[model samples]
Target: MPYLTTADGAEIFYKDWGTGQPIIFSHGWPLNSDAWDVEMKLAADNGFRAIAHDRRGHGRSTSTYTGNDMDTYAADLAALVDALNLTDIILVGHSTGGGEVVRFAAQHGAGRVVKIATAGAVPPVMVKSDTNPEGTPIEVFDSIRAGVLADRSQFYQDLSAQFFGTNREGSTISQGQRDQFWRQGMQVGLAAAYDCVKAFSETDFTEDLKALDVPIFIAQGADDQIVPIDDAAMKSINLVKNGTLKVYPGAPHGIAGSYQQELDKDLLEFWLS
Candidate 1:
């Protein structure tokens, strides 16, 4: 229920729990702080401060139509960290949230942050271009936009099913997980979600990855349909100066949710190392 007012006056909702080393989490597109619930609790229970915030226009945050881009997202995160005067932070991000964390490190993190981690993240670039020919086609993202404009609810439901690999063969997901995904997606603003499709798909994080002087932990889903491994975390890992890359076999975009226990253990190890 806590909120932090951004420089632009947007009310950003955040959850801060426990105390000790701070681990800040940033959720993916159209999702809220709830996306990091499992990770946050795990970290908090282990004597770490876990914090996550709803990006503007998502979840309980103010639903502003403008500033749905990466810059604003990064700035909002930086503002939250500054407001709390948090230090020695371990910043973790998923998908678009990964983009937010890297951008924050490159632009504003500096002395305040200790390390960075991203899973199934969108970085370096997700849309194809001359430089990133392996990226997903712009047409694919266009379809996503059309889907959102058509039926946001159905679109989110379908995505939730695929996001966690529930639609894949030999896969099973709980009703609670499905409901959580749909619930988080439905909480986002329609306009903000629409604009964010472009923001996450097109924004380049090349410089951000290259600028990372601290140790970075990169996790990629080998079967991720949303952001392919080659174009995202894989390439991002190569750019970081002190990066450790891990590829989860058969994992989808929602690795943090689908493989929560493994991810929690890996993160704890990373924090200790």
Candidate 2:
């Protein structure tokens, strides 16, 4: 198993495939790098070096109790990029992974990154504030923490439906899709997973988005229930100096699985462009 050990002693398991321009993938909350398998394969098949790592404390990586915050997450990502000695990278992130991508670029990417793409990502902050009146209420995140503490298994099962929009009308998500989400969520460490709810829900990425100078492709599911398009992708597009927004009319938060082909092609085109 290929792994990169962070400065803080976290072992980040990664998958590196194909050989060409590097495309690094970051996954969402409570899920592992396996979540990006389809997209990674698509990149690899198209003559790109696809790389994805299980974030610290998720999937096969070290599940440390400390350093579950966004800054730490970004630093862990920097460790991976430095360890691989990658340059001119194309970063792709989904959901919380999107937050990680922007944060990493803002703090560490510099000349290393060429382009970025995010799908159904959480960015520019998700929690409501006096200034950001349209954001999701903090109480909603409190409830998520409550659910994680009360019964995480049931919580993940129910969240999976919303994550993939299976609970929505006309959704074509399969039982396997929901099951895989639950399986991935369950694999995460309890402490890390619990701490991450706050990290993904409250961490402000407004400054991070503004710092990006590379071409950014923001893809959103118009009907995304997990991270509403308005609060996330819609707001994110405007913050990036060089950005392109692609809205999928009825897609859900888990667009990578539910709308795989469309996203894969769009990402490939963006990279080639």
Candidate 3:
């Protein structure tokens, strides 16, 4: 298995493929690089390099229960880019990964970043602090953290329903798709999942989003439950200087699988333009 050792000596598992301008993807909480298979293949076929890393403690990467915060996540990404010498890269992040991209772009500067997009991202902050009034309540995330640490398997299964919006009545679903998502969630470490619940929920990306003067796209599924579509992606676009917004009606948080073709077309045309 291929791996890149971060500065802190944690081995980060990653997939790097094809050749051309790079498209680096960061997966959401509790999942690995495996989250972007469809999108990665499309980018590879479309004449670009695609790279994705399983954040430390997730997937086949080192499962050490340390340094699982957003700063470390972005730092690990920086190490990966520096080690690979990738430039003009498009950073695509979903959920918590979106927070990582914003921090990485701001902390490292956007010279290496050609473009950025956050899907179901946790940006402009997710938690309702005194500073940001309209954010999600901390108690809601605390309940999630408790649920994950208590019964991971059951929690993952229940989460599957929310991610795909299968919890709703009369929504047809693929059993295989649900099973795959459950398997991915189970593959991640419980401690990592538990810690990152708070990590993603509390990360404040307002300054990071404001600092970037580059083109940004915030795509969200209006019906997202795990991470509300409005606060995560929609609010992010409003904060950035040059930002494009796209909303998928009635789509769930895992819109990558549900709307892959549409997203692929968006990326291809966005890159070409």
User: lDDT of each structure?
Assistant: 0.90, 0.91, 0.84
Query: Residue-wise lDDT of candidate 3 within 181-202, one digit each (tens)?
Result: 8888888887788888878988
Lowest lDDT 10-residue stretch of candidate 3: 255-264
Cα RMSD for predicted model 2: 1.0
Write model 1 residue lDDT over 105-145, tens digit each, in one string.
Answer: 99998998899989988998999999888889999999999
Give TM per candidate. Answer: 0.97, 0.98, 0.96
Considering only N, C-alpha and C atoms within 3 Å, which residue pairs clash in candidate 2? none
Arrange candidates by lDDT, descending.
2, 1, 3
In model 1, what are the clashing residue pairs, if there are any?
none
Ranking by TM-score: 2, 1, 3
Total backbone clashes of model 3?
0
Expressed as tens digits, the lDDT of each residue in 1-273 for candidate 2 is 999988878899999999999999999998999998888888899999999999888999998899999999999999989998999999999999999999999999999999999998999899999988999999999998888889999999999888888887787888998989999998889889989988998899999999999999999988889998988988999899999999988888886454877888899899889
lDDT, candidate 3, residue 221?
Answer: 79
Q: Which residue segments of model 2 deviate by more than 4 Å?
A: 256-258
